[model samples]
Target: MKCFVAVLIIVTLATDAVSEASVRTCEPIKVAMCKNIGYNQTGMPNLARHTLQADADVTLQTFSPLVQYGCSSQLDLFLCTVYVPMCTDKVALPIGPCRGLCESVYERCYPVLSEFGFQWPAELDCSLFPAENNHEHMCMEGPGERTAPVGTVTLDSVNAGGRSACRRLIKPNSWVWVRGSSRCAQFCEAEVLWESGERRAAEVWLATWAALSFACTLAAVGAQLACGDRGSAGERALVLVALCRCAAAAGWGVRAAAGRTAAGCAKDSTTPTRMLLAHDGLANPNCAVVFLLLYYFGLAASVWWVVVAGAWRASVLRPSVTTSGTGTRNDRHSSLLQLAAWGVPAALAAAVLVTRDVDADELTGTCFVGNQSSKSLLALVIVPEAICLLLGTVFLATGLRAILRRPVPVPAPTALLTSPPQQITDQTLLRLGAFAALYAVPSTCILATWVYEYAWREDWLAAPVPTEIPSTQPRPAFWVFLFRIFASQILGVMVAVWIATPRLKALWRKIAGPRKPPLTKCPAGPPPTPLTLHCYATHSHSLSRSQMHKYATYRPPQQHSYRKPRHYHYSAGETIL
Candidate 1:
């Protein structure tokens, strides 16, 4: 108990630290572009008209209206003709002027128009516009001329030429016109603030933590199973539950991966490799994986509990009983029959689950990891189980208490001379009753709770959104979500460890283990065994001397046996029969 408490405290402290670290170290996304939209056609001249129309639709639906419809066409044309040329004015440019310039205008300005769908574009080129580079706004450099050290004229002078020129070009009632130019800062500085090491670390941490959690969960479950001596029924039920959980978890992982893949593809359609790479680089899959792992371990604990219950009954309670077709009942092999009943159903269920797939969508990256099948199965199996467990526990406790409290009776000397008939004792009866109740009640309660939780509502037992570290949330009102985890998993594991430890096991054996059989009453050793004999004398079945002779014909008769006996006459007063 002390060890468990200490470990829990350490884990809690670590988790708290992690949560605090997340708050401090993790950075929020800047709400940058996530998607963009544009015409699919290529080499379409005068794209400004279509672009303006698209922008108009996007603007009306999203941000406040910046320009009226009558001026929309003119604004588009002016942007295409003026902003397009000015931005691409580098000497000896690789992509060329008009440089698919309409594409650049669309890419730079789409984020502002499309807030929800504006995503980052793949290529840095102008051609990768509306669909990709959906930055909120375009950065337009001020007109400039610079004089080099050799007195060669250049556009580097911000105050004298570039700044004044840009200020003079501003149009009335325009949302995009530049107000001024700063010599010390480049126009590109605003968007460059996005790239950060902290963001990358956070993503990596989430993914790694999720993976680790899942692995640990699986390990814990497997460890529990390995630690116990479980019979076939328990083994079967556990396998069924585990397989279902695994399948569902796989489905969810696949779904998460699919979403990531699709997002990546939409961002960089030209490069399939990048999309695939991104698919492999996400966090939610880890969380789903860990959850599945926990399910596996939880299943193990439940199976062990069932095993213990069954074993306790077989060892301490139910007396062997047997029945024949006739009035007399047989008392042997009853335990064997009971064991068979539990084993058969469990074996079948395990076999079926092992052979069959839970669902068909895991491979498509759309369904496997977070699928609902396992949780559904849990709901199916837990209710009856919980009820059975609780009832059995109550029955056992009651019987034990009754036996200890009952008074003993004294036997008379005459009665003590004869042994009592072989009949079941009150203690034996109580053990059977206790076993039945304990085995049934708790399992049923648990099963019911699981069903209610699963079937009640979609988000009734919602897990926190995926994160890099384990998080602590305040207690939820739902008993299924909170108490079960704390009791059945955390507390259960601790209890099992405490009970199963070598020292505890030794102590228990000393207290309640089997003892040597009592000595027999015969002072001398047991006498030679005697063969049982049966004799019958009836009116029609008495054996005569002649009959004895006939039956013994093969053997010679003795002289006394062969001779007929002569009897002496008795006096009338003294009668001889």
Candidate 2:
């Protein structure tokens, strides 16, 4: 019996000695970079199983670039705590950072590292760690809770609401939201992956079209000025369309040249990340200016298209009996068109600014309204474009109907070659129709894209596809944006093409032609007079004087008398030249 008791005691002592031998000791840190890790001593072998501090310090050097990249504010701390864990003799094992900490740092910095062709280390699997610091299973919360005793709090739900709101505003397509950090950024903004070329292509495409559009519109406007065609109110309204297109297209280039850094992409922390939540207004100067240039001037371009079709001429054309009323009515109509064009766009842009709805497009890389929130897209872009298109279409149909139904004038044999008083042409009507259709098609396509964006925005966010995926197959939406980009440039090119009448081309040729060589000697006579017809009539004829200038039948006079070759009548007080 004594021998049995002795055997049992020996077994107990052996088990205790084995456990005591296995106990890990806290060792002083030798790593220079990890010195600030809350505690000086760490348990060995660490999460990486580096037995000595020197070994741990060496392995950690591999992650130096990620730490320096500054993706997460807590990256350095997380890395240090992971390699050289906090150790105390009071506990049997060392404690490492929580899974939450690892995940937060991993998500923020992974994309940055991936850009360099690095993969996340297998040893640092976040799923293997504890979720939070607690008595039952202790782990670090983060820097904020580094000094706190274990078993205290969890940061899981702290940022949930803010992150959710940001997700909605971003409406990420070829990008992802990293809300773990204080700032939520699009994944591609921080790191361009294998699909970097696609993003770059978008920027270049927009910039290319913008340059083309700008030149086209400028040529149209300059042609009007150079040809001396600005006198007609219809031509004046057409010029306004060209001017607005120029301004709007110029804004498109800003985003292309600057790429993702341009306006509508403000990342200031002082600003709210969510559009719907930001009633305080967008404080970004660039964002506001670009918004005004693109939306305000773009809408104005559409508005002026309506005026070009029906308003200007309808109000100004008179029966010649009441010519005095034309000026007052035309001026009033002009004011109303200006108000609808400039004032309405200004009001709408102001509303967008106040709501802070601006965001960058992934396909175009240009900052524009309604790209972020589908609600904003519906309210600001779709509605406005639809209304303008409708108004322009209605005006165009009525103008065409009136022109087609007009009574044909019976002409005197002498007046066979003379044009009727009305100046509306088949060519003019076609241009107006072209302009409206151009606006309508693009606007309709854009509305379709937004519809797709709206329908899929949430589903996409719920299960995000890897935005930087490398494959030839792309989403169907990509082609939709491509069409949109291509179509937008079409308007400017067509406008310039349509307005380049034969007369305009002749004027351009005259201006571009070599200048007449200076006269070798001073002319002894005044330059030949233009408007040989107008030289005799110092003033425009009044409508009441139409009968006075009508052609009369000619008769041969007596042999002694001289007969005028042309039977032209003169006003009562006019000089016969």
The predictions' CA RMSDs to the true structure, in order, are 26.7, 15.8
Give one digit per residue, the lDDT tens place, for model 1 in 1-577.
9999999999998796465334332112111111111111111111232222334334333322212211121223324222122112221111112324445334334543453244433332444233221233333222222312322211112232222222232121111211121111112111111123432443344334334433433543454455454322323333333333333333333434544234221112212122211111122343234333333333443444444344344333333342232113212443553454345344434442353212211112221111223343443345434544664465456545654675665666675544343233334344334434443443454455566644543332222334999875322133343333223323232332322343344455666877779997876886655444232333344567776556535655567763343223433334312
**Model 2: per-residue Cα lDDT at residue 388:** 73
lDDT of 2 by residue, 534-577 (tens): 21323454323443354233444557733223323434344433
- The TM-scores, one per candidate, come to 0.27, 0.53
TM-score, structure 2 vs. true: 0.53
Local distance difference test, per candidate?
Answer: 0.34, 0.62
lDDT of 2 at 255: 54
Worst lDDT run of 10 residues, candidate 2, spans 271-280
